[model samples]
Target: MRVAVVSESFLPTVNGVTTSVARVLEHLQRRGHEALVIAPAAGSPSEYAGAAVHEVPAVLYRRFPVGIPTPLVHRTLADFAPDVVHAASPFLLGAHAIGEASRLGIPSVAVFQTDVAGYARRNRLSAAEGFAWRVVNLVHDKADLTLAPSSAAMSDLAAAGVQRLARWGRGVDLDGYHPRTRFEPEVAQLRRSWAPNDELIVGYVGRLAPEKQVEAFSALRGVPGIRIVIVGGGPSESSVRRALAGMPVTFTGPLHGRELARAYAAFDVFAHTGTEETFGQTIQEAQASGTPVIAPRSGGPIDLIEHGVSGLLTDPDDPRSLARAVTALTGDAGRRARLGEAGRRSVLGRTWESFGDQLLSHYESVGARGPVLTRALRKVDVD
Candidate 1:
């Protein structure tokens, strides 16, 4: 099937949404399906995994660029004439694609990847939270099917009155992110360089955005004999640095592929402070690397972690809760190793291939259902 994927953000941004979209497009092409990507211009390659990428004019939203979809989107999509449209996030560019697809009477699917309401709340836009929910419902209600990346997000969308929702979580590249990487001499040396003096390495991977609650990590400074390594860059980096000043924090702007995998493997404990995650891909990545995770008890982590079983979950609102969780793990090496082992086992079969297969099945079902309904209507008219 010919698929059109529209996203607000894409490559050169270095975020989960961009990575997921790129993987999906690549998988579609590998399966002999044609895919077209529409996203904001970010100096990304014109073509990706054999899929043609069409970039629109955009402006900076914090550290990332937000695409402004104009009327030309309709014309561009009409020319492609996709069998189905897949809107990733469906806020800005994706919203326009859904609107155009609806006008064309084409089957469309929207993936709810971000928590806009949570973002609004984090940014102190309390008044905009209601409006954000309304906009989410408006955009997703148009799709033939709406995919929520986590159960928490599905619940939020259902509460907001968004219809046709389904669960669609993320996957980790287990090949790259595995326990074996930690034993590698280079990775061991890299870890030694970061920690340097028998200090425990507590790492956080993801954008240093306000919604990410990266400032919450500052609370970990009170934990002795530990080094804080934050991997990823965002507009809030300066603020986070200032907040974590004079602390044992090392900022590694951004790392990808093997370097990223090595970083995850090197961590004694992976700390995720974001409560707004639709699906925490980095959490899974950390688990895949056999690193115990300490994520908040809200959003995606609620689904990913099993309290004391696979990993630990703490209170999202309280920084003290995060500190206590980290302290517990740091003091008990046996528990940390056990949690890390169990964490690895939890994501054994959760791979990108499996994720793509499920996604493609959903697309086929939605695509087939549309024509079947049309045929049934025609039969009724004839009778």
Candidate 2:
């Protein structure tokens, strides 16, 4: 089936939205399905996995591109005439696209990946919380189906009065980020470089944004025998660096693909500092790498962790909970190994292929009532 994926962010951004969209594009390409990408113009590639990428006007907001409203969305949809529209982390641009799709009598699937209301709370924009949720509700309300990545997200959307909601989680790269990577020569060398005196590595991977609460890692300042590794860059880099000052920490800016996998494999414990995550993608990557995880008992992490079974869940309200969880695992190699192994086992069959197929099923079910049944899966009309 032909699908048009409208994402709030895309390549060169490397956040959860971009990562998931890229994986979906790759999946569609592999399954012989035609696809098109509509994203913000932030130096993204012209094409991905054989699908042509159409960029729209965007403005920099907090150092990230935020797609602005444009007539291009309506024109593009009218031209391509996809069977279904997949709105990835629907926000301003996404809401507009969904509205356009509805006007064109096309079905849409809105994926609720970002928590804008939660972000408002984190940024102390309490007044904007209601407004944010209103926008979220309005955007998702138009879709034929709204896919939420976690129970927390589903609950939030439901509370906002969004209907036609379904729980859809993100997939991990099983082979790329596996337990075997720990034994790789490159990973070993990298670990040695980060922890010269053989310190336990407590790592955090993801953007250093304000809503991410990355500064929470500051509580680990005096922690013993653990080197903190911060991967990924964002607007909050300077402040986060200041917060982690005088600690045994190393910032790797950002690492992708094999390097990102190696970073996860080298960690003794993966510490996710973010509290507003709609879906903890880094936590999954850490689990896939056989690294014990410590995430706050909030948002998406709640669904990903089993609290002392597969991994540890800390108190999101307590600033010291993260540091304490890391301390508990720092001296216990056996426990960490057990937790890591369990985490790896938990995600064994949760691959992109399986998730992609699940997505196709959703498309088929939704498209069955629309133009997809009669129209052939063909190339999009660029003109």
Candidate 3:
């Protein structure tokens, strides 16, 4: 089947949306399916995974490109005549594409990967939250089906009155992020450099943005026998540095491929500070790396982790929760090993192949909707 993917972020951006789109394109290519990627212009490649990428005019906002709505989107979709449109993290660009797909009578699937409303609330932009949800509902409401990455995201969209919702979680690279990487020479070197005194490494991998609550790492300032390693860079880097000043913290900026896997493998415990995550992809990476995770008992983490079994969950409302979780793991090596192994076991069969098949099934369901099929796509367990 031919698919047109309209994404808010792609390539040079390298966020969750871009990563998801890349995986989908790769899967489509492997399965001999044709695909077209429409994204904001920022010196991205002309093609990826055998799919042609169509660049659009965009303006920079907070160091990121925001695609300007254009008539080109409609013209492009009309020309492609795709069987389905996949709207990744629908916002400005995605909204326009979804709207155009509706105009062309093409079935479109809008994937809800970001929590715009949650970001508004996290940043105290209460007035903007209502407006944000309004935009979310307007964009998602137009699509034939909206795919949510987690139960938390689904609940949020349902509460906002968005219809035709389904659950669709992201898949991780089990091979890249595995338990054996810890024994690699580079991983050992990284662990030594980050934790010179052999202190337990408590790592966090993600954008150091306001919504991520990166400053929460400051709570571990007085904790003993642990070093903090933050991966990924963002607008909040300076403030995050200031917040964790004088602590045993090392900022590795941003890492990818083998370097990222090494970081996760070298970690004794993975603690994600963000409370507004839609799917918490990094947590899955850590779990796949055989590293125990500590995340807020909110959003995607609630679904990804099983407290006291696979990993630990802390209260999102409590500022001391993360630090306490880290401290608990620091002193118990046997429990950490048990939890890490369990974490690895939990995500064993959740490969991109299975997820890609699920996505294809969704596209087929979209094609089989209405008169062809009496009911819409049935929601299924994400396991």
Candidate 4:
């Protein structure tokens, strides 16, 4: 099958959406399918061996690297003429994807990966932020199928009138990220030079944006014997530091390869405060490293955590709840060890191979008109 995967963000810009999209494109290509990408030329697509990447000209917001803010990629997608269009983000690029698919009489799909409105709410916008949900539905309304990454997102898409919705879920690279001990002589040297021994290092990974509620880092100020470590660089880094009142936080500026693995290994527990993750991935990475996650009981984390089993899901808005959860996980060595061990295998079913096999089934059923056959059967029953 000729597939076109369209998105505003791609590799070179590290985030969950880009990572997941890249993986999907890889799978399609590995399965002997021709896959092309329509996205901004901001990043390198050479990583995917057999996939063709066609970048369109677009303007990225000066302050925000996560989005292009405004773009018109319709012409690009139309030129590609793919049999199936997979819209990774349901914004301008997504609209173009569905529009081109319709013109070509092709099956199109949209993947829901983030909660824009919840992001807005975290940024302090109330009523105006509600439009994210509306926009999500409007974009997918044109698709033959819409794939939501999480059950929480599925409920929202359904409420917004996306009738033909199914879950594609998310996956983690089990090999790229695995349990690795021994912080090496170099990493250990860097760690010793940055932080002293016996400092309870608590790690937070992902963008340092306002929607991420990174200011919540201040909540850790009162946690005794704790050193806050932020792993990703983002727009709000300076503001976040100011909000933290020069609190002690070591920003490793996004580690890759073994350093990243050790970053996960070094942390005693994972603390993610963002309420808008479609599926918080750092939680999975931390878990893969046998590190317990202390996440909020909102958005996708609710689905990722089982509270006291793999990790503890606390109140998203309550810093006290976050503190308590983190405290509980870190306080007891035995409990943390058990939870982390369980979390190591938490992603047993959520893998790329599994996701791709299931998704291929959906694509085949779409091509075969399974829905039409089902309705026809229902009518015969009535007869």
Winning model by TM-score: 2
Superposition TM-score, candidate 4 onto the true structure: 0.89
Q: Model 3: residues >4 Å from true position, as ranges?
A: 368-383
lDDT of 4 at 110: 77
Report the lDDT tens digits of candidate 1 across residue range 1-383. Answer: 77888988888887888899988988888888888888988887898999888989889867688889897687667667677889998787888889888877668989988888997787788789989999999989889999988889989999999988778887788998999999988889878889999688999999988888899988887789899999999889999999899999899989998899999988999999998888899999999999999999998889899999889999877879999999998889999999999999999999888999899888876763344453444344335
Q: Residue-pair clashes per candidate, as listed?
A: 0, 0, 0, 0
Q: How accurate locally, in lDDT, is each candidate?
A: 0.87, 0.89, 0.90, 0.73
Off by over 4 Å in 4: 65-79, 123-126, 182-194, 368-383
lDDT of 4: 0.73
RMSD of each: 3.7, 2.5, 5.6, 6.1
* Superposition TM-score, candidate 2 onto the true structure: 0.96
Per-residue lDDT value at 145 in model 2: 95
**In model 4, what is the error at residue 165, expressed in angstroms?**
0.9
Model 1 TM-score? 0.94
Residues 1-383, model 4: lDDT tens digits: 76778876786777777888788887887787777777766766654647777666666664433334233454444454455678887677667667766755567877877677776677677665768767877788898888887788888778877789887777776765666553456546655655686666788888887767877878777777777888888888888888777677787787877778878777877889887777788888888777888888877888888888998888876778877776665568899888888888787666788888777776765572333443353344335
Candidate 3 lDDT over 35-58, as tens digits, reads 999999988999999999999999
lDDT of 3 at 54: 94
Between prediction 3 and prediction 4, the one with superior TM-score is 3
